[model samples]
Target: MKKFLLYFLCLISLTSCSLFPRDNTKSVKEHTGKKAEEHQITPPDDKEPNHSLLENTMELAQEGKVATSNFAVHMNSINDVKKQWGPAANTDQIGGIYYANYPAKHTVFGYNAKNILVDIRSYDEQLHQLTYPQIVKTLGKPDYLRTNQDDQIYGYKITQQFELRFIVPKNTEKVDHISLLSPNDTVATTTPPYILPIKGVSKNLSVTAWQNMQNWRNQMIQVAKNHQNFVFLNGPNKKRVALTFDDGPDLMNTPSIIETLANYHLKGNFFFIGEKVKKYPEVVQKAYTNGNLVLSHSYFHHDLSKLQAVEIKTDLAQTEEEIFEVIGKKPALLRPPYGAVNNTVITTAAQNGYKIVLWSIDTLDWSQMESSNIEYNVLKNIRNGDIILMHSDDDKVQTAKALPHIIEELTRKGFEIVDLQTLLGQKAYK
Candidate 1:
């Protein structure tokens, strides 16, 4: 469990400098599900961190400030930081800027000649499972997307004098570390192409059924890559399940479904068709403001597989525009109408910055099955990381009826109901 950081400081006064590592450069154990949760923005601990602290760390990070609990007040001098986080595991200097690296705390402090803290770069694994989409949800899009060594940087100009940068290692959407720093301490960085989110199995899968689901998802990911770009069949392997409603924002069923979710204090993913969203803008806005996620299901209920690439793009763009006008942020997740997607549909969707999301459990609520049958479909076939698909269109009377019982039963079974962002660990909106 020990890691030796090689602190080799390049003396180049030209390019932007990073704590290029040596000695132990093997990537952090590719954590999945529960293990990924263990490494958070804070130092590693046996006990799970308070939810408030996680929020505070991320909230403070936006303003280029470390949390007060994590020695933000001690940045006055190197001596002050040493008193709190303890001495640095090692020290290095580059271009007269003194640096202290804390291996245990997964932090580094940079000081100018005056010996005052100027930058904080944390290589904590807490952010290891977070993808670019998840960060986009929090910080909006990065102001600058740059490539730095083996990592890509998503830089935000937090203020005129400071920048908050993300260090995403190559080939993975996970963040290796982050820096809350001054502009003077770092040089300008260049932008790169968009990075895609990764799909992984959960670490909590002990049952054979869960293991089989994990294997199926892995094979599907590979098969998807071979033909289309990518498609997310379900969420991360976890104890979480997402209840997604499609073809919604109608006057009746959508509202009833939303009401049912609210009564249970739960949030579900709603993929609204563009025409319906425009027809029921109020419904769309209400769903969004009520803490539910609204995504795209294309402009019309057309079979996208038969459409040309350009035509698909047009549909997706129009649908997103409608969603953005209603919710104020463009969606990054898409569910093709009728789940009809060929390579063209997938390729065009990727070009427009969307990941195709399909359901693992189909409740057949559209079939007008009785509430009990719909409940049976979900409760009987539910597995870890399932995205349960249901309809919220105006005519689905049975669906609205089945929702409440399903929510109550899922809670009783101890299945954590989560939003699409939490379920996929990706951006819900861009």
Candidate 2:
């Protein structure tokens, strides 16, 4: 009787275990489904991210991974960078350092000798896109701040390694311009010094030389102020003669003249016609880049003396505007068309902050004269502070041919051939 009772109890226990196994399995499956529902990544309500936002996010992700703290200083080569981040959007070289600029990412990578990456700078477009409060929220409080009254620029140093600068216009909360910089990188602060846009002039000149140049320029300006209608024909007692070419910046003869002047280590002035300047701005830019003086020869090359005051003003003003457009500054000197300035031309030019310039010696190159005659006309009549006039146009082929001989002869005679600005110790542009 005891054995039969024990077998009945064991059968009951086995039946209960089998019935509970299915319940346990169902419970485990329900828990897994709940977990999957909680963890699933759902698309945003808007569906797709804006293209710009998506691109920025991707760029940020890549930058965060590759530019881990101080990684830029450790990067070996530009090739390595290309391998890691792909090709840069734009590349430039300045002062022996290479820069890879990524506009989309708002980042710049600087590389030194052997293409070793030296610095990485990232700019936040949010400075312009977002409000000031938003920028503060995103970047946090800066470690340092600076304000410039002259330019109305506000600067914030977020860290010793990072800086933000903005151009804050007057009476506006909007930040119009933004830039990021790496304070630790010497290349970041070392910009090419603002040498006046005269090409070929060495900014590496001695301190005393620079001082003397400044003093002379100041004196000339004072003199101009005293005499309103006078044209400055020569400079101080420096054993130099200014070689000025007029009616040009034409493609045909201007380049050859520039090359010849460069070969002799001399400089010349090209008084450009405003109409021609519009057509050949690159030539004018080339002359300026080569350290040559580029001044106005009037807009239409029409004689200012013959025109009415308004007409003269219009012509001169148009020429000045065009020159400023190309070079970012207006010429301080003006040569009247055919050197025919009357009282009206003088008053108009003076009103516009231009000092009238006329030649001391005419080469007759505009007359299509022979190269020998051009050379003799210069050499025979050359003197200290003499301004010799030549031409650089299609008809002035003889002028280009005679330039080398003119420079060599002047140099041999102990005369320094200089541009009008240097000869007069005056700033070429304002």
Quote each prediction's TM-score.
0.50, 0.47
Q: What tens-digit string does per-residue lDDT give for candidate 2 at 22-128?
A: 11111112335442213223333433324453234234333321222223432345556655665555444444345665556655665553455544544445434
**Model 1 TM-score, 2 decimals:** 0.50
* Clash totals for all candidate models: 6, 3
Give the lDDT of residue 119 in candidate 2.
48
Measured over all alpha carbons after superposition, the RMSD of each candidate to the real structure, in angstroms, is 18.5, 25.9
Would you list the clashing residue pairs of candidate 1? 39-126, 40-126, 133-427, 145-191, 146-190, 202-237
Best by lDDT: 1
Clashing pairs in 2: 199-290, 199-291, 200-291
Quality of model 1 by C-alpha lDDT: 0.68
Q: Give the per-residue lDDT digits (tens) of candidate 1, residues 73-121.
A: 1246665775566545545555445566676777777766455666777
Q: Identify the runs in model 1 with alpha carbons over 4 angstroms from their true place.
A: 1-229
Model 2 whole-model lDDT (C-alpha atoms): 0.59
